[model samples]
Target: MTTFTSFTFLLLPFVVFHVANAAIFDIRNNCPYTVWAGAVPGGGRQLNPGQSWSLNVPAGTKGARIWPRTKCNFDGSGRGRCETGDCNGRLQCQNYGMPPNTLAEYALNQFNNLDFFDISLVDGFNVPMEFSPTSGGCTRGIVCRADINGQCPNQLRAPGGCNNPCTVFKTDQYCCNSGSCGPTSFSKFFKDRCRDAYSYPKDDATSTFTCPGGTNYKVVFCP
Candidate 1:
């Protein structure tokens, strides 16, 4: 009985560690149309309207992003292109998707054992999105449900998405490559529509949000 108690005690920490560091991401498509959901470490999934996909993400994952690809055509082998958010023409994205896509960016178990997340339009906007925490008592959520696509500026309009000024001009002013930049008229256009989203590269002050570690998240398209 003593030996069994010792073994059980040793296992407790492992179970606690696993539960405290892992997160589940539920991605859903509420759009009237189909959406190809893309994630860096989670790969990709075809989500028809009302469909959903779940992903298990490990602790300490950084620079991770989730987004939706529209108007994609994949072959039997999962090789294809998307009108927006194409990641090297592969259904299972091995890298970040191309621009003109709304983004859900996150970092898990960072400083202070907190999870950081945000909805970003720095790459651009294609679909409406809502990113929220479903667990860990995190109540705040972010959303970008603007008509940016239909009202996209002429220079930034793409085939099936609204391109960011950086994609159209590629200048440091729009890209913030020099590490010193601020909002522009173009960034304001996006910020005005979606106040919760990161309209520019340095929009951290208001755009970024935090939750306690082990928080599960839900990302919904057209929410």
Candidate 2:
């Protein structure tokens, strides 16, 4: 009653506006899923190389889909099932040497909402897969191999390279003294100032890698 401050009253409107804006933003960004477009779920009867599909995902989400299944290299004499073959039949070795599994798993869990989409049932391999609506292309019969540079290294194969919603960007070859390709060591150096590891290619661009002791390298693909 003794004092009514003009300053206090003037600031009230601004504060209220800020709070209202924040509330509106929260409402818009609340949901973890988004509507997707493409073949109906479980309707992917056949997927051919160079084919394209689309899926719409929530805006807040990271890149769409996760590929849990690994590409396998079968032994000529083995039975042919990847999981049943000798050495676990995994395309690469188990553990750190193997391709990034958790990365893909996390992606799948977040996008698919923990739903399982079998690639085999969709006319493909038995690995995990998901779709993203961000992409576009023609859907048709009599599939043909696509001529995208830096994507299909094996040009000889027709109607047999690349799958919709999934593409093999590049095959990395780690040049080590052992003559095998892979990350052979892990290190954090320079008083822990820098930590480094390897990464696979994406978007036709090689990964930028830095290692301990100031060792840095970029993966380059050769025809």
Candidate 3:
């Protein structure tokens, strides 16, 4: 609930550009329970077992986040709240999700015509998730859909999720607010399990990944 910018410390491996890029996302939830999937730019939807949602992200969208909310109850008007990953207490999130949630992050058509993408646990995690570039010549997929909840540290454990160090402790040591922070035992806990995701600030060098421009992505929940 603190004021933190998502993917603020991310540094694109490609150069900056003006031309826009477009892509489609197939967000599928394989979990038995229903998940309220939310996105900053792409909107929100509910996915039940064996169900999926799709969205076409227009060119020029940046810093987009796709995440799932748990323990949510919505009314007919899409007005409601969630126990985890709640975005301003709404079913359709035009905003960012709360902490203690797993995140799929991306920026399309960045510098040098490359698209940057990653699965981020820096916000903590409620559910396991995978982010994969489906097309545009990407061979690697990013996933953090690990059983972190069952093994979450006592201090970091929340009602339905694990809290990132920065969210739970809110200290310079974990937050890297002074831009001097590095990996700690907590971040190591995440990195050890999800090697490709960002465990903390300054994790760009190895955690961030790139694909060619115009690449489509698939975000799978409970994968």
Candidate 4:
């Protein structure tokens, strides 16, 4: 009996390690229209209003992002372009999508066994989004629901989305290429609208959120 108890105790840490290294992402489209959802490691999916796609992401995944591609038209071979967030005209993205997109960025099981996440408008805003932890007792949720497209500045306005200043001007002020820049009027415009989102490259103080490792997450479009 004592030997069996010792074996169980030894197995417990392995189970915990496995659980801490994996997560399920529930991607949902609550918009009034259809959207092509894009993810770096998870590929892409077409989701109509109320539809959803679930993706299982492994632990230790870094620089992962999810976004919605608007006004997309893919053929039988899953090849097409999107008005925004187009990833090389492929339906299943092999890489990150183009800008004028609202981003849900995450790195799971990172420093101190925590999951770091944020909603970023640094690429620009194409859709309203809500990113939240659904499990692991994490109650923090970040959202970017402002009407950024309608209120986009003239220089940043695009056909179906708003462009970031960096995409427009490509200057160190907006792009932070020098890595020693601060907020500009353009970045402030986004920050004013979506206070909880990353307006520029260094908007980390209030924009970033953390959850316990292995926490499941939900990314809702038009939420």
Candidate 5:
């Protein structure tokens, strides 16, 4: 199969000192968004929709893919997922339809990047608002594909309760049940869930999310 490419150049200045191509998914006039899939040194910044940039993908990079950042919303408010057609509804945004063009192709076809290849999509074909990569453990973990396939079962706490880390989550059953990592009660649930299992601090806030099943499920702690 053809290689996938992406970039993360926004309104600000960005430079990738690697060997790869740049693709542009410019949605400025239409949706005010951009997606790049490559070895971007700096993660991302205030990216303008219409502006163009190059994705410097490393030659030997194992697996990589890129998508828009606005597709999924991780905020506790539940409004971040963008379900109702441009944040016009209450439900979480969903991704559907055919696959989007590779970042390299998108960039090269639209912009002036020549080091990339171009993959074709059906005419008037628009990808769903929320889609992600679950099969291939690509970069950023998820893409703009909407659907439960991408969202992990317990990685994110259900919308009903507050962003509590102790909630019974499948993504991090041990950490979720055992308040040892979170504020959950250190009772049987804790022992029953994560007793004798090794644990570690993923970050400074004591927030640690793990992957219990396939590499796809990202056990994230939403504080």
Candidate 6:
């Protein structure tokens, strides 16, 4: 019993570290207008220009996406609407936003004890954005600052954003049928400009990136 107790004591620190291993995402808005930042499995906030909001995400959090909404009008009740990236007309979003919004996606503690992250245009594009792994073995942060809206393909242009082909067409060809399709001219259009983003269904080779778990990240708008 004495030996077992000593072994248990030795394992306590490892357990504590594993349980306490959390990733902090510091989201900043550098755009000229206010940004209603949204995250899943994480809450939402409004960040004015030069303002920053930080959220601590626990280790096991998965499939979390962060995006910014523009030109929002929220009353004292945190209920209102946004011009772009609005999430169910609520300020503190209880759900994901309607797309045509650039997405910064991450899943922590995935296979091989790594954290997978990417800037996904798969949802579409609203603002010039960036997602960087600020700490740990993540060096492939995506910076998608290209003016996709300014020069968006005429067919893919929306009011305040550029729509991805998948959103515009919604066909098996554009949506990829969950693994059995490929890119088209529209995906190539986004790929040619934003090389670090997901252009098509099978763009994981370059778009997806991984980091050692316990890494910290930052998502910036218009940066």
Error of 2 at 153 (Å): 20
lDDT of each residue in 108-164, candidate 1, tens digit only: 776666778999999999999999999978999998999999999999999989999
Deviation in Å, model 6, residue 86 alpha carbon:
1.2
Worst 10 contiguous positions by lDDT, candidate 4: 1-10
lDDT of 4 at 195: 94
Model 4 CA deviation exceeding 4 Å by range: 1-21
Indicate the residue-level lDDT of 26 in model 2: 7
Better candidate number, 2 or 6, judged by lDDT: 6
TM-score of every candidate relative to the true structure: 0.92, 0.20, 0.90, 0.92, 0.23, 0.90
Span of 10 residues, lowest total lDDT, candidate 5: 214-223
User: lDDT per model, in order?
Assistant: 0.90, 0.19, 0.84, 0.88, 0.24, 0.82
lDDT of 2 by residue, 106-197 (tens): 01112212211111111111222221111112111111111321242242111322221212223233222233343211111110211111
Q: Give all candidate RMSDs, comma-separated.
A: 7.9, 19.7, 5.0, 7.6, 16.6, 7.2
- Candidate 6 is scored at a TM of 0.90
Ranking by TM-score: 4, 1, 6, 3, 5, 2
Clashing pairs in 2: 36-56, 55-132, 55-133
In model 1, the clashing pairs are none
| lDDT winner, 1 or 4 | 1
> How well does model 4 score by local distance difference test?
0.88
2 versus 5: better lDDT goes to = 5
Q: How many steric clashes does model 4 contain?
A: 0
Worst 10-residue lDDT window for candidate 3 reads 1-10
The number of the candidate with the highest lDDT is: 1
lDDT of 4 by residue, 1-223 (tens): 0000101123367656764566899999999999999998899999999999999999778789999999999999999899999999999999988989999999876666677899988889899999999997999899888999999999999879999899899999888887777889999999999999999888888888889778999999999
